[model samples]
Target chain A: MKQEIQVKCSKGNLALIRDFVNRWLDEQEVKGVLANQIVLAIDEACSNCMIHHHNCDGRSKIEVGLNYEGETIYVEIKDSGKAFPIDQYKPQAINDIIRKRNKGGMGIYLINQIMDEIEIEQQNDHFIYKFAKHLG
Target chain B: MEIKQEKQNSYISLAPIGDLDANSSLEMDECIQDWLEKGESNFHIDGQELKYISSAGIGVFISHLDEIRARGGKIIFSHLSASVFDVFKLLGLTEIVTIVKEGAEIAPHF
Candidate 1:
């Protein structure tokens, strides 16, 4: 099954996005820790796209897609904002982040840890961040 | 998200209701900052009411860990639902931070 949601790149819309993901996952019978992890990963990805790349510009928009096929779950976020190259991003060491008292890098780290596969697809006018996780 | 604050001896306990995502985390960050500015560092976060958490919420805690420790204070969490606790475990925060297991009192850790 496949589902998608599009929202303005405003931070205020994050909760709505999360609710949509959670409810959709529920409809797919993905619950408990697994569902929570997927939700967290999606939240991190969308927030990074909106806040870091688009500067939470209410004028910008982002699309999130969730698909379940066989035993794998695939999620994607598409936007026309700056491409963060999350697939190429090397998350900073946790110790370094704590030492610097930074709040930014951990989200990417969590996204990497949670998602099984991550790819960046940059098109002529937009960018797509694709992530996959195996149910096994 | 509404964060319920209560003073518990030398530490202040904060319980955030509902999901703690990117936007709402800013409010939590500010709450901690306000207490820090007022010379309060020790914090006990009650997670019973926290239904969901994203990395942004986790970041709020990590961002303040150093400063709080430097001030000779500690930030501890207790009463986390299983799923909420799993997020901390997933990030390996369970090793970096002190969390009072269920059925344990904050006094011992504090």
Candidate 2:
């Protein structure tokens, strides 16, 4: 199955993105903890794109694409905003994060923990963040 | 997100309803700040109506943990939906924070 959604780059749209992904996951019969993890990962990626790349500018847009093939599920987020190198980021240790009392840095960390594979593709005019998870 | 607040004994209870994402988390952060300004420290997060949470949502608690603890107070969570609890576990928060299981009393942790 394949599905896609386009959302405005605004913090207010984060809930909309989650709802869209959740509905698609539900239609695919993806339930339980695995489904929740996938939804969280997608939310983190899009949140990063909107906040860091587009600065939560409502004029910008991000496209979310989903595909389920065999035992793997693939997610792709495409946008024309500045690309953030999520794949190269080294997450801080949980203990260090607690010591620093940081609030905003954990989104990328959670995304890395939940997604099995992550890649960033820069095309001629846009960038795509690809995240995949294999069903056990 | 709507957070219902109540003072129960020595702790302040905040029950956040609906999804707590980046947008709504700001409200929860501000609410906590307000209580802290009033010298209130101990917190009990009733997650019964909290259906969903993201890293930003959890960040609210993480950011305040040190200050709350410095004031000799604690924050305890209870009645989290399975999915919400999974998010906590996935982030390794269950190790550092107190998560009271459903049907479990919060007094011990609080």
Candidate 3:
């Protein structure tokens, strides 16, 4: 089964993200630690798109899609912002980044750490972040 | 986020519960800065109930780290949820900040 949602880049939309994920997770019968992991990963990815990618411009919206294929759950977050330079992006060492007090780059790092697999691609003006994890 | 204050002697314990994301972090930063300006520096952030925190929230802590250290005060975190702890660990804050597993552990340091 698959589900999809589009959220604006406003603070109010965060609750909608949470609600959509929680409802989908419940319906999929995903529970316990696995469910929590998915929720956190999805939250981080969606929040990154809303806050960092679009900067709450109201001109952009985040599209979140979820797919369940019996064995695993897949999530994709699509943003209509300018193409993010994923090639030059490096995950900063946690200590170094913290010491410098940088806030913007940690989203991708956290998403990578939390999700089992993550893939990033830029198509035209959209940046796509796809993540998948097996539920066992 | 919910903030509750407890004062003992010269130390102030600021307990913030729930997700400390970008939107809520500004108020938190102001609250901490206000306390620092008043010369209350010894802080224990009771995070036992705090479920999640984003980089923006962590930035607020990092921004005040130097000021707190300069004043010979420290901000300690305790009882972090596993997921929150992971975020802190990923940010490499585990080494710089004093993290306690229990609220009681905070007493000995202060």
Candidate 4:
């Protein structure tokens, strides 16, 4: 089954996005811990879109797509703003972040830890972030 | 979201109930800022009721840590749920931030 959820680029709308993804995952009978992890990952993805690509304007729009096929769950987040610049991106060590008390890197870190495979692409006028997870 | 504030002699505890996402993170900051203005230094976040927190929520704590420390004050956390604790652990926040566990009181953390 496939479902799509859409929200404005505002941080104010993040709660609604989290709820929508959670409810959809719950219906797919995803376990609680795994479901919560995915919810976090999805939220981080949208946040990156809103903050980095759209300049956190909240005026632009973001869309998320959820699909369940066999034992895998796929989530895709699309933003129509500027293309995502992922070059030269590398996750820092956990100890380094702690020592520096960095606030910004945790979102991408959490997404990497929670999601199994992530693929980024650009098509037409939109940039897409796709996340895949496997059920236990 | 519901936030319960407990004022004690040595410390003030602010427990945020429900998901501490981007929206509630702002609310949490406002409440903490109010306490800071009132000359409340020691703060402990009772995380037992907080089932979830996003990166934005974590940012709130980071944004306030230095100010609290500059005044010889402390902002601590306690009784985090497993999932919430995992985020703290993952970010290595437990290293720089004081996290009270094993049923310990918040006062000793500060």
What's the DockQ for every one of the candidates?
0.80, 0.83, 0.46, 0.48
- TM-score of candidate 2 to 2 decimals: 0.97
Interface RMSD for candidates 1 onward, in order: 1.0, 1.0, 2.7, 2.6
Candidate 4 global lDDT? 0.82
**Candidate 3 lDDT tens digits, A21-67:** 87899998886555656776777677766766778777678889999
Using lDDT as the yardstick, the better of models 1 and 3 is 1
Best by lDDT: 2
* Candidate 2 local lDDT, A70-121, one digit each (tens): 8888999999955788888888877777778888788888888889999999
CAPRI tier for the interface of model 4: acceptable
User: Which lDDT values do the candidates have, in the order given?
Assistant: 0.89, 0.90, 0.75, 0.82
Local error of candidate 1 at residue A135 (angstroms): 0.8
What is residue A50's positional error in candidate 4, in angstroms?
A: 2.2
Ranking by DockQ: 2, 1, 4, 3
List, residue by residue over B19-101, the lDDT tens digit for candidate 2.
99988999999999999999999999999999899999999999999999999999999998999998999888898888887
Tell how far residue A103 is off in model 2, in angstroms.
Answer: 0.8
RMSD in angstroms, candidate 1? 1.2
Name the candidate that leads on TM-score: 2
Candidate 2 docking DockQ: 0.83
Error of 1 at B92 (Å): 1.4
DockQ of 4: 0.48
